[model samples]
Target: MTIILKEVLESEKPILRNLYSLYLHELSNFTMNLNLGEDGAFHYEELDDFWRVDGLSPYFITLNEKTIGFILLLERPFLKKSNDYGINDFFILNQYKGKGLAVQAARKIFEEKPGQYFIIQVVENKRAVAFWKKVYTGLNIETNERQDLIDKELCLIQTFKV
Candidate 1:
């Protein structure tokens, strides 16, 4: 399948909101083993809050113009270095998992806009740890860990030095 990753347009907010709700619900269910009440109604208000923030560049993963998933790429100042950039909030729909779409999308992002270092955070939960291990091992990435605010949660930061 030809998956297209494109910048989200303002007019597509409604559809993107619905897709994001599905993405969040699936992610919560996968990690927490329970849905965090990410129904359409609950997400509608949340999406409104998200849009209010500036510098949030959300993208849509589409197959023939139909959005199947979404990812938010935010360029923010790094805590380690004030001049560096960070990418945050990446998610894909559960139905589209195991398709290698994320790797392709990430490659496209780097190709279009290169960075000195690309970092992604993985939670310390069992599933996330396993997933990140595969990704890091496949990509030969180096990682470090730090304590997160939540108990039993750690910030597994993997960096791609380019």
Candidate 2:
């Protein structure tokens, strides 16, 4: 399977919105405490914000021409000390889990968005931690782990340089 990261554009908002809805829904139900109400999910308002920001990028993850997931990379001034770039959001459909596809997608992000990067995962989300751990270790990348509160919830923040 060929995994690719395509820069999401304004005309592709429909596709991004659909994926974002699913991503937020799954995360809310499985990992985070956020509630998803009837056919609607959070993150609708932030759709355009990414395009407006200079440091934020939205990429669509595709495998063999099929859209499966997305990665949101942001450049923050500071996090856990020095890293400027962050993996703000990453999600693969339930059908696409356990195949190391995400690792490849992440590796692509590491390549395309080169710099001292960080990915923050909720501490309660063991799957996320494991996934990020695999991506970091499989790529032979060095990581510095830290703990920080995001939205009043503690999160495991992993920082690395690529």
Candidate 3:
């Protein structure tokens, strides 16, 4: 299947909401092995803030014209220690797991928009911890921790230098 990553548009708001709802439901049910709760779901207020942020961009991941996941990138501050871009959110349908679609999508993004560093924060739960470890190793990435957040115990902050 051909996987495509494109910028989210205003006309696709409904589809975005539906996809996000599916993700939120999965997270809420603890089906995806993530630690996020209902509070993690995107809300209208968050959407408004995202729209107003010039440094943040939302991307939709599609396979054969069907949207399967999304990724949000938040650019770094000009004076940041690392000129890395953050992967704010990356989610794929449960049915599509283990297909390496996420790796493909991420590779595409990195190729299209190259950066020196790429960061991803994964919840420190069983499944996610394992998944992120494998991803980091398979992709030859280096992992680290960010101590700024109070919830660091529940989160694994990883960074990759490309």
Best by lDDT: 2
lDDT of 1 by residue, 1-162 (tens): 677788887778888777766655644533443344533332534455345666456778776776767767655421355323445555666666778776656555655655544454536345545655666566565655444543333455555543
Which pairs clash inside model 3? none
Could you tell me how far off, in angstroms, the CA of residue 42 lies in candidate 2 after the best superposition? Answer: 3.6
lDDT of 3: 0.67
lDDT of 3 by residue, 87-155 (tens): 766778888778888878877777776666545444534565576667767767666655234233345
Q: How many clashing residue pairs, candidate 3?
A: 0
TM-score of each model, paired residue for residue: 0.68, 0.89, 0.75
In candidate 1, the residue pairs with backbone N, CA or C atoms under 3 Å apart (3 or more residues apart, or in different chains) clash, namely: none
Candidate that beats the other on TM-score, 1 or 3, i.e. the better one: 3
Top candidate (TM-score): 2
Query: Can you write out model 2's per-residue Cα lDDT over 124-161, one digit (the tens) per residue?
Result: 78888898898878999999999998887789988789
RMSD of each: 4.0, 2.4, 4.3
- The TM-score that candidate 1 achieves is 0.68
